[model samples]
Target: MLQAKMKNGQLITLIHLSKKEVEEIKSRGEEFYCPECSQPVLVKSGIKVISHFAHFAEKNCSLAENGEGAYHESGKIQLYNWLKKQRYEVQLEAFIPSIVQRPDILLTLYDKKIAIEYQCAQVPIEIIQNRNRGYLNAGIIPIWILGANKFIRISQNRFKLTPFLTQFLHQFSSSYPLLLLYFCPITSQFVKIQNIILTGSGQAFGSLSVKKLYHSAFPSLFSVDNYHEALTYRYWKREKEAFRQNVRGKLYGEELAWHKWLYERGTHYEYLPSSIHLPVKDQYRMKLPPWNWQSRLLMDILHPLSKGHVFSIHKAKYSLKKYYSPSVHFPLIHSHGEPILQYLHLLERLGYLTSISDTHFRKQMIFPFYTNVEEAVKGDRRLLEVLESKI
Candidate 1:
């Protein structure tokens, strides 16, 4: 809707046109057509809304049916102009011939091609994945920036990760935690929620960095920040306490099943070892919450053997598969790596286990058990120290 083709096949954006120019073009009877479907479109210059093109009511264009509203139009234009100001070769709503997709803004950085999509409205998850795959197949890195208005702030440092936003999380490297990007055109601010470690299925604790659009360069988007060790542990401790007190709250859905499985194993939620529910950066990959799979790993894989028990990570991964499911749909997430292995590595580094072979580890010590939140926080503090060292 931002850019349309004129009768002469030249592309023009209504946002860049002056009111007088729009009036002159309308008076002269110049016609514009949808760039996606190549159907005639009408130019609307409204006082309340930004100038843009739209298809007629009877038209069945897919783009028109999607309804790119004023906010999306403005955001798209703002991003295109922002990238253009940096002297990057950029295109607005450029149609990709190979995939027949029109990315909002396409940028050519040296030899790299990037497609920036400023999604303001709710879209089907399948469609989003398809678009991402299309760009990936074309050798274009697709960067999805969410609308800042979509963020539901829960606290100073935490925000609600809606199902829609969860799919867009980017994990560039296994070492780098999941990161989210949000832009508010109204405030002209870009919010980068980086190094996010989810505390629960729906809640996350992370570093939120906000910068003005004009002040930040492109490379800043990919930069990861150190998560405050004390702040992160403080929040995790509270979550652990809540989990401890709220047994009834979790008696539903998959959690109920997990609890039943624990009951069969002669252990309950509160009695699990302190290390079971601690923060694991790569825990996002597992379907069950941290307590379930982490506890299962302790009970089934790590706790059954004597002190001399040596096991391979591959065996642990295979044993944990029933509890494992892809929780997030981030394409950049390393699919081949096991999140449980990462947790096992942390345990190894903490001196509870020792690496005896490339993929096998020897149990050095027994799992430490804690009776209260205070003891749990101490265990979490030790784990947090290992996590912070990676930063």
Candidate 2:
């Protein structure tokens, strides 16, 4: 509601006018209304909040629900100004007639159109997906930047990533890691959560970099390579130990069933080898936890095969139907296949499997099973050393 249409059909932006000029307009009894809906709106000039036009309380406008208090408005205005300063063509609260959706800010570059959504409030994942679909159909790339105030900081390089928040993550390219973007209007800082590695369903360790809006440009957001490998390894070691120690705790749903399945195979969950549940960047996209899917792969597919026996991707995907998530579109990120493939590749890199073809892989070494948790931890250390060398 930063820009409203005057009665004469001229656009008036309250933020551009001085306080004295805004008072003069109000004293002259000028009438302004919403630019999109063309409904009567009143200019609100308050001491605490930014000055803007608001629709009547009884009127329901599409933008009203997505609209929020001054914090959200200020952030939208700031982002719009920042993009404009970069010399990109920008529009505020642009209503795409074809999609009937209004993005907070729309930008048109040389040959590409992008929609920037500054989300300051929590919304359903379904709504987010729907908006993404609409943008894709219209040939516009949608970008979501969350409010930094909502970021739950757990440690220096870790944060609690809720299922709801994961829907907003973006991946610019295949080589780049999945990233979360956050902006703080209060401090004019942008926090990019880069190189994310999920330690659990709701927990992840990553590098958090905060820079002023003016200090970083648009392209800088796409290139994020800085990370702490030693810190990540230490964190993963701690998580592996916690997983082994917490095995006897309460379980539910697929987790409980998976444990029972392991028992039927004459093996305990804690005795599973370290190779299972190893780190994979795309593990977050799976329907089941790493332990569930990884254990299933070993117990059902890889362990039973004789030396030199090969398995195809189709066989792997079908055998692991229980771990497949419902088909969901992840914007800008191409999940190569089931996340288990990444784990298989890691095993390949460790000299256990060899890639014979695009769809088939041959088993080289027999599955390694540790006798107890102590041995499993040591195995993980060796795995970490190999992984570090590649990194």
Candidate 3:
């Protein structure tokens, strides 16, 4: 195992230390139990790594993997030590019998007890709700510290939250203020904290400023409120509408025409479907390009039709006319060519086609033209018959 460097100029390895060495550290009174599971930890000795403690398990612990939970455990230890330095009466991994839940850290200030949950992964809403109930039943304040990239607090009466954020909020009502802490893995630090005000449904409705707590290095106070106007609900509605419009705008017109072309020719021609595997001449192969960031981006921007589904060009055009001016149609047509080229290249490379540059030979196509016709027909037998006659 790798060794960590300690501030005391001692290198500590993860290997088991002797009983005498463990006793020597305990004599110093620096030893502590795991806050979460009450497991004993002892400092190990090594030259290359700094001195650090490891849990002394009577039996092997399952949470020994090098992952987010392990990091959270380590962070909890560091945080507990830091809090102790500040003279706060704190308990690590304190279990509350009333709630049947264990909090990462519990701090008692006079009569008030606070339960802090350090979440490093996506936890279920039911779990959070049960835990929240447990803490509230125990007359303790529950605080959740989420991992960075999990959420962000936008403004008063308007916050942008994720599914995970929604789940966390749904379990606990608007009783306690939610503090959104952004954890930075690169710097190994808690970068910032935003105070989140939640709605009745547990959605984050707004945010407040943070007050730096530890010598401008840690946040001490953050407050968020003023979400009574249902602004977040309105903002979310508008955002969803805007996204729909953007998607439609990117995919309409000439792009619609390319989709129509695929729909009409897909079955007779061996066209590859988008992001699915289909049978080629003798074996199954990918119909569309592999799903990747760049390809997805291109698909979003270009709106190419999938070989698995046919595009109804006339219907799409009519729909576009209902919402857009005729002058804006052609630009969408010109934008889809790049994604088409990309699709064609992918198909050729996957052995669905013979050549990347060759676009004329219909037999080289992988998708059956019938897929597009199914889309164009849209459950109308007459339309199917008409399309079939044309083919």
Candidate 4:
């Protein structure tokens, strides 16, 4: 939307133009056309708004629902300037003909090409996926940097990570950890959240760090090695306590259904063993909440087996196939490993199970239910002591 083609097939960008030049463009009486659709467009420039070209309201273009506000415009310019000052090969609103798309800022570093998209508004998930697929298919990596307004921070270790927000999580390379980036144009501050681990719907545990734009470089995003994984464990400990207390309130949907199942088995939330509702590093890929599926596996399979009986990971996952979300749920995560193994390994460390092989686990000690909430809290405290040491 920033670059348009003249009638003579010459491309013009308004990013580095002066107000006098913009006034002359308005008086030049020359026609400008959109690069993507080749349709006539009008130049919009004023004191309040940034200089750019817009397609007519009646026309439909893929780039129409993009970078509309001066906030979006100003942020892209700052980021482009930052990269340019670092002596990196960067372009503003670079259009790719093969993909029929234009990224906000495209940076070509070394042998790799990265398309940086500065997003300030909410859009459909399918649109995000389609754009990512297009960039990936063209051998380019797409990094989506969300606006500061899009980030809802609950605390130092807590984040309200809705599905729309999670769609923007970026894994720069296979060796790097997962992270989400946010920039506040007004404040000139950058917020980086690394080692993001989803615990439940719309909630996660991560290490959040903030830095000014001028003090940071491109490699800082990937190489910042210092973070407190202990904070993640602390957040999980609090969530487990809250999970135990939720049964005192009115339950609905999956929670209500799970309560009914517990009633038939003569068990309640406070009576559940410490193993239930524990955290897994990749709970985002599962359709059911941790308690529902973990409880089901314990009651239906693991709890009924003899102490020496062994179970295969294949058989366990097959029995609870409906609880797992497809691998496509998390497009940004490159390495897809089963989350159940983490839970099993945790149980193994806590003396409930033993690893017989890479794919099989043998039952070691049977799990026990608590008689009261206080006793359950004690069990959690004891279990988390070992869990924290291992983490």
What total of clashing residue pairs does each candidate reach?
Answer: 0, 0, 27, 0
* Model 2: per-residue Cα lDDT over 200-221, one tens digit each: 5688888888889999888787
Model 3 segments more than 4 A misplaced: 1-70, 97-100, 149-160, 170-179, 182-213, 216-219, 224-241, 248-391
TM-score ranking from best to worst? 4, 2, 1, 3
lDDT of 4 at 269: 79
Q: Compare the candidates by TM-score and give the number of the best one.
A: 4
Q: Write the per-residue lDDT of candidate 1 for residues 202-262, one digit (tens) a residue.
A: 8887888899999999888888787665566667766776776653753688888897898
Global lDDT of each candidate: 0.78, 0.81, 0.41, 0.83
Q: Where is the poorest 10-residue window by lDDT in model 3? A: 277-286
> Model 3 shows how many backbone clashes?
27
Residue 328 lDDT (model 2): 63
Error of 3 at 112 (Å): 1.5
Candidate 1 regions with alpha-carbon error over 4 angstroms: 27-30, 58-60, 172-177, 226-234, 246-250, 322-329, 333-337, 368-391
Instruction: For residue 32, give model 4's deviation from the true position in Å.
Output: 1.4
Local error of candidate 1 at residue 28 (angstroms): 5.0
Query: Which TM-score value belongs to model 2?
Result: 0.89
**Root-mean-square deviation per candidate:** 3.1, 2.7, 19.7, 2.0
Model 4 lDDT per residue over 1-391, tens place = 6789998898998867998898899899779998888888999999987889988775667777564588888888888898999999998888888998799999998899999999998888888888988888899888888889888888777888887887887765566667889998888788898888887657787888988999999888667557655655677877888776654567788878998999999999788999988878767767777888889988888999999999998878887898887766566667766778777887897888988888899999998999999888877877777788876
